[model samples]
Target: MHPFARSLVTFAAATAAAIALHAGEAAARTPAKPTIAFVHGAFADASGFGEVTSRLQDRGYTVVSPANPLRGPASDAAYVASALQPVKGPIVLVAHSYGGAVATPAAKLVGNVKALVYLNALALDAGESNFGIIERFPNRFGEALRTRPFPLPDGTEGTDFFVDPARFREFFAADVPARAVARMASAQRAVSLSAVQEPAGEPTWKTIPSWYLIGRQDEVISPAAQRFMAKRAGSRTVEINSSHASYISQPDRVTELILRAAR
Candidate 1:
């Protein structure tokens, strides 16, 4: 064979090999099924993300809803960090309500997180808390809840707590099944007044690619407030016509948003 022709053939073989290797690396980096870590808001446990989790899992995602202590953001973030420690691939951290406060700092602790999904979730600015935002705009729901408080066994004020079954269904999760709403009401946790009062240091949404699900019918946290937070976070927003518990009321939409972030 001519020397120049032989060299050309060798060059072509090398180029093909490089292309194949690059393709393999790209596939390896493309996460088989991105892991999704869900953080629930106040008055609920990890179980609150049941519907969301089921939907993600059905679509081939490894979902983790860490049992946050509900103590405060710092502790909750620590708890979530522990849950995130073992994850192997890319992650999409989904936060609902107070869960956003927890996941904000928690996402910083982990390296695998690719994006964040906020479901009508809180998005605090520097040195701001949930209480500060709400205080700026007093709403009927907060006023009504404040009228009838649930004093904790420790004697601390629990004004940020949830209401009973009938109210929970009507206001929070009217679209969810009665039995599920009852279970949620029964499992409701008394969020500390300090939790809302404490300021978030640095919100993660500022640096991360974030997607927000705004509940148009939210009463617990006003729909207006959700929009405000979403704007400040510079998040890609998707509005759902559901209550604050959109994960329960509009699970499919919530699931779709999460999967979008995972992509």
Candidate 2:
């Protein structure tokens, strides 16, 4: 073979190999299925996110909606962060209501969390407590709650809060199905008062890119407060004309925001 022809063949092979290597690198950077970790707020469990979880699953995403414990903010955060220890890929940590307080610090503990989504959720800053912010931006839902004392694991007493069942639709999910709201009211988990008064952990939104979905008609967390927190965090925000349970009444809109964060 001619020396010139041999040189040309060698160069072509090298170029093809380099192109293959670059393609492999790009594929590695793109995750086929990113994990999404959902944290539910007070008076709710992982089941609170049932519809949203199903939607995400339909879109080829692995969703984990862990029971939030509804304990205190720090302990709840630690519980959620520990759940993520076994997950192997990038995570989009999504929170609802008080769950936002949990996700805020939990994200800091996980290195692979790529995005944060708050759905009518609390985005408390450092040194801030949920009740403190609620006091500052009072909502009608406060009037609807009925508190009762319950024995803790340590045998001490703790306060548990619940919205009046008759007023559940108005306070939490007026736009949701009546039957569903009825079931929710019957099965509602009580949120410990301590959880609301506890100071939140470090604000993860400071470092993580976040998206917020505000329930404009929310009586639980006033719309004004949601806007203030979202703006303060510099998050991409969208508003839905629904109750505090926007994810239930306006699932599409909520899912759209989550998809935006995942992308």
Candidate 3:
């Protein structure tokens, strides 16, 4: 064979081998789509994650948005645990607002949880409740809504706590349209005060690799408090310019974060 021909043949063989190795590595590194369990925050049910869940399902992910009892963490955690029991694969637990509190104990109940995605969610330390965490910070929303009487039998009070159609647009769902916000507020459930006051026993974020979505314009939970919680949890933070109901305001960004964790 000619020397030039031999050199060309050698180069071709080397390139083929490199391509084969790269393909193998790529196949090996590809991760399965994790079962994503979404937990909604105070005053909201599973429906709050409708848009986000639909987006995730479109991408071929197994999505579970469980309806929390709006009870204290212990009871709500039990509900979350039961919901997770049917999942047959790895899980990426995603929580928003008060749902973050529920995710703590629920994540512990599930053995296959791979990561946590918090959407302006609570990140409680040991023996800390949502109220306890906020107590340390300045609470404009709490102060404003403190005077408004809770219509529910159980005296829980907050702007986003009841989900009035008029107030929802102004406080939680300002970015969303009137009809959607009206529907959301009409269907909203009242979270128990016990849930807010009850402290988390063991925070799951402490052990899991966590990611946080910070709602920069959040009024319900202070953006400052969100930052503090995210930092303390050692989370990877992404900011969205939205109100307390950021998942509704920016479903795409929220879905993207969840998908990142699923991978």
Residue-level lDDT of model 1, residues 1-263, one tens digit each, is: 99999999999999999999999999987758778999988777888778778888888788888876666787778889988999997889999888898899898888778899999788888888888878775566654242235566799655555565457777667677889888888887767666778888887788999999998878778888889989888999999788888987778888888878877
Candidate 3 lands at a TM-score of: 0.82
lDDT of each: 0.82, 0.90, 0.83
User: After superposing candidate 1, which stretches have Cα over 4 Å from the reference?
Assistant: 1-26, 143-160
Model 3 off-target regions past 4 Å?
Answer: 1-31, 143-165
| TM-score ranking of the models | 2, 1, 3
Say which prediction, candidate 2 or candidate 3, comes out ahead on lDDT. 2
Candidate 3, 169-209: lDDT as tens digits? 67776788888888888787777666788878877888888
Best by TM-score: 2
TM-score of each: 0.83, 0.89, 0.82
Which candidate should be chosen as best, given lDDT against the real structure?
2
Predict model 3's lDDT versus the native.
0.83
